[model samples]
Target chain A: MKLSDMQKDKCVRVKSLGVDAHFLNRITSIGITEGTTIRVVRNDRKMPVLVYVRQTLLALNREDCEKIEIEEVA
Target chain B: MNSIALLGQPNSGKSTVFNALTGARQHVGNWPGKTVEKKEGSFTYKGAKYTITDLPGSYGLTGNSDEEKITVDYIKAGHADLVCILVDASQLERSMYMLAEFAGMNVPSVLVLNMMDVAEDKGISVNAGELSRRLGIPVLPFTAADGKGYDRLRDLFETELSSPHLLTSAPNLAEAKSLKEQGEAKYTWITQMLEGVTTTGSLDYKMSRFDRLATAPVLGKFISIGVILLGFIVAMAICMPFMMLGSMFPVLMNEPIANALTAIHIHPWLVSIFSLLIPNTLYFSTAMAAFVLGVNLVFGYLEEKGFIARTAYQFDGVLSKVGLQGKAVAPILMGFGCTIGGTSGTRVMDNWGQKMLAMAIVWAVPCGSIWAVMPVISGMFFPWWGTLLVCVGILAYVFVLMWFVSLVFGKKLSPVETRTGMIMELPPYHKVHWGHIVKEAFYKAGDIFVRAFRTVIVISVIFWVLQYSASGSLEDSLLYKIGTFIEPVTKIFGLGWQSFMTFLSSAFAKEAVLGVLNAIFVGQSSLLDATFHAKTSGVEGMALAQIMSQTIAPAEALALIFACTFNIPCVMALSTTYRESHSLKWTARVAAFYVGSALLLACIVYHIASLFM
Candidate 1:
């Protein structure tokens, strides 16, 4: 599922960053990589969404959030 | 004496450690040719003195930003005898990444695990001895905020020192790893160290309870607005006393002071300068000083307490829509206080183009000087509700103006970079020490006062000279001739010539707008005109707005107020804009654009208000 589509507070493991390489590098440098755990702290339509990854909070726009591929953690 | 620099990410307690060590002996300055601050201080330990530099914090030492570039350059130049790397103990997995980056530099280093108490509270334990063996450096758990473990920290610099070796090439790492896998490889190595040397006492993460309500994606936006509005009101309220004292200057000056000066043998020109120029100057200087200081104190406290990061996080999407980063919210909000301070605040932005574009948009927001005079002007003619309309109207206009300008200049300025997402670690909320806040407010107010005084005084003296001209009494002064001459051109924007003159002078200082209106209206109107009440009446400061409303139609008054608020800000802001951008072409172009747009908006406001009239 796309990261932005995840329900609030649901933990997910990142699959692969489906965004452009430039964005992928940035996300990686910030400690987000494949298999990392992320939780959607908040996601609202018409507003920026908050994601908690690796003990840091990141605010991503809908477009950028859509580019991150993830799977619900069992 | 040897020198060592303290380096860490923001909120990693670098400043705490610096204060713990140097305490009151620090000298602060700016990096050469950059806005980033350079802080250095020295202390003596065991008969040996050492100099300490606090490097600006950054996510990593990349060429992505000025702070990063300065960090790398400072290290490569071999300025530090040893680099004391500070990391948050509770967030080691992520904070240690900087240590991983530092390993490539081959500089001698020591790791100070700051916030050790917090780490213990989180039920985490880091085996410093074993981890030190793996990374080929000494690691010590520390709580810098309390000056705990100072002995161990100093010993690493003093006696336990070893020749630092490259940490990138770990002994147990597989040889197959390539250069590209350096980050992953380091993490893998760190994970191995964690396996043996660390014990996770609990899996239950401790999160701030306040974060839930504050970061609620939808509600958070509204909360952020409320917080900002509350911030504005509190700041204004703090300055209320000074503003009242300043308001009394007009009465105090023209009556007792002016009469006494004339009663003495003081020259009339000197008397005119003192009576006309000095009172307004004192009034504005006091009012402006209070406003800037209050805004910085309030906002700076919030930022220190970590509320600002959540605000940036919550508004990331909204900010991105306007072609700015989430962090840009800080400067834009601060622009309401003082444009110069706001422009300087953008130093944190790594992208030069985005910084420049943000500066452009900030000017469109009416600044604190305008905010000071706004209620004063509107109170007489505008019902309180009408005044609220203008306040809201300014906010609405600024946002729309941002949208329009973003479309026009977005691509050219902030062309998409690789930073699709930001990493914002919101530090735990805490009370700010007011001593530092007051110190900062003092510096900010001092800077604003000097800059405002320089620009306003020069322009005011010129205005005074023109008003008391050799031509004749006030009717034949140079300003009267100029005001009447511009009637045809000023009429296009629905501003009477006198109003036009005040608006023009406002570009030098918005705080002077009320004073100019009082002088010109009192000078020009017939003595019998009861409404032109400033010079001839018992009531002094509040009479300008009433007289203006009575003399001009509401639409024209609205037009004049609209134009004055939206016009190019003060001379201080102009020079500051120029200084920040350092591009004469961009500065002139932006100023020209503001003047043009302000007039267009004024004309539109005038015609719309006229329909109702």
Candidate 2:
């Protein structure tokens, strides 16, 4: 599922970031990578969904969030 | 004296530590490549002086931007003897990446585990000695805010230590040509080095009730609105004492200067040149400048505490819907405090189109100076209801203007650059230190005062001169002729000759409008006599607003208020918009847009109000 589709407070593993190279690199530089664990801390509609990645909160607009694919962990 | 280059990721409490170290000795300027600030300072320690240079914060050394280039270049250039690296102790996993990259570069460094109090509160115990031993560096755990463990950190600064390479156990880098490979190497090394040396426990981030509301999507919108309203209301409240100052303003600034000038027995014309007019205009501008400065200090304090980031977060969706990014909110919020600040504030956005569009839209917001004078003018014209009407009208128009201009400019200035989404590490709320507020207020106010003083001094004098022609009556003045020339055009917007003249003269500085009026409109040629004449005359009130209302119709008065508020910002904002955008084309386009729109808006308001009349 796209990261934007995930419910708030759910932990997921980042699979791949289908974004522009420059943008993908920026998020990656901040310790987010494929296979890193992240939780959707805020997923309210009409607001940028905030995700908790490695003890930091990042706010991603829906346009950016839709490009990142994620999977639920057992 | 030893030189230390302070380096860290953004918001690793580097600034707090820098402030604690240097106090007020910092010199701030922009870096060569980007508009990002370069701050350096010096302080005395035990009879020796140490200079500190704060390098731009970057996530790692291998990014593509100028920030990455600048940081790497600074480190490799060996400008400082030792690099003082700061990292948040609680989030060692993420913050350690910088240290790993620095070690990879083979730079001499000492690590500081800052915010030890926060880590201790979270129950994350850092074995500083063991970690320091493994890293082959002195790691001093510290909290820069209240100077916890700072003495030990300062002592370590005094002692010479072996240059530490914390990635001692990492394997040699593979001969990978990919940029990704170099970044991954540093990332992997950080994890490997910290494996046994650091342990973590699960601790939830403490979110306040206000934070929960502010972060919630629906509630967040309300919270943001609440914040904006609270900001406005507080500014209004703070303006109360200053408004009292405004009442006594003519008495203090105008009366004395006018009185001393009257005592001079020089020729009348020469006395007019050297009269209280020039000095009184300067004084009036100083008061207006102070009002803007005070409002911005409140803005700066909130921005320091992270309210602006929350504003960006809360408005991200709405801004995106309008073809802008969430980061656009900061500049817009700053537009309330001051438009020039708003225009200059857009430098942080990476996209040129976004910056231009943001600046163009920010012109719609009525700035602090407008707030200062509009209240006074509106209260004068319509009494209590007039101020309310103009304020409510401006607010409604700002929204309409932003939407309208976006449609006109948004397509061409749409976001073409894919920018990094902001990571909202909301700063922990702290009690505001009044000391810091006052210092910043003066620094900011002093800067603006100097600029306005320059502009207003020249313009107000020209305006003062224009109050007289060779014929010397108020009607024969160059101001009257030019005001007559524009009166017809401005009359379409319900503005008369005096209002038109004030608008033209005020383009140099808003406060100069009242200054010019004091010299010209009452035909008394002096502020004190003008007040005295209006009071003794059948006019019920002695205030300038009362005299102004007797001459201008109600419909015209409302239009004048709207026109002045919505017009192009003062000369200061014009030059600032140019400097910040660094494009004469965009700056000219923005100024032309505001001038055209403000006039058109007033025309519309005038026609509609005329129908009601």
Residue B283 shift from truth in candidate 2, angstroms: 4.9
**Candidate 1 structure quality by residue, lDDT tens digits, A1-74:** 89989987788887877635555545555666676787777777755566766555666667767877899975
Residue B445 Cα positional deviation in candidate 2, in Å, after optimal superposition = 4.3
Please, what is the whole-model Cα lDDT of each candidate in the order they appear?
0.69, 0.67
| Candidate 2 CAPRI classification by DockQ | acceptable
Candidate 2 on B1-613: residue-level lDDT in tens?
Answer: 3888888886676776776677668776557645445779998878778888888777766666666788788878877777889997867777887786677666567889876766676567788888777777778887765544656766777774333333354424676455555556766666666666666322244467877788887777777766765765565566456545644644565555546767875555555444445454445445545555556565656665567668778776677655676657766876887676666556445345677788888888778777876676666667686578778878998888898888887876773342345544554454444555555556555655565556555655665566656655767777778888978877887778887766665465555445555555455544323322222233223456657767877777777778777777776676556544566666787788877887787788888988875
Best by DockQ: 2
Give lDDT tens digits, candidate 1, residues B1-613.
Answer: 4788999877787876776677657776657766465779987888888789999887666336667888999998999888999988877776776776677687778888887777777666888887887777778888766645677777777753445534534423355253325546655655665666765212234456677778776677677767866776777788789778976876677567768999998987787667756676666666666766766677767766677777777766667777787767777876887776566556435445677778888887788778887666767677899989988888788888888767766766666553355555666665455665566566656655665566556766775665655644556777678878878887888888777776776676676576667666654432111111122233255666656767888888788788888888876677656545656666787778777877778788888999996
- By TM-score, how accurate is candidate 1? 0.76
lDDT of 2 at B269: 58
Task: Count clashes in each candidate, considering only residues at least 3 apart in sequence or on different chains.
Answer: 0, 0
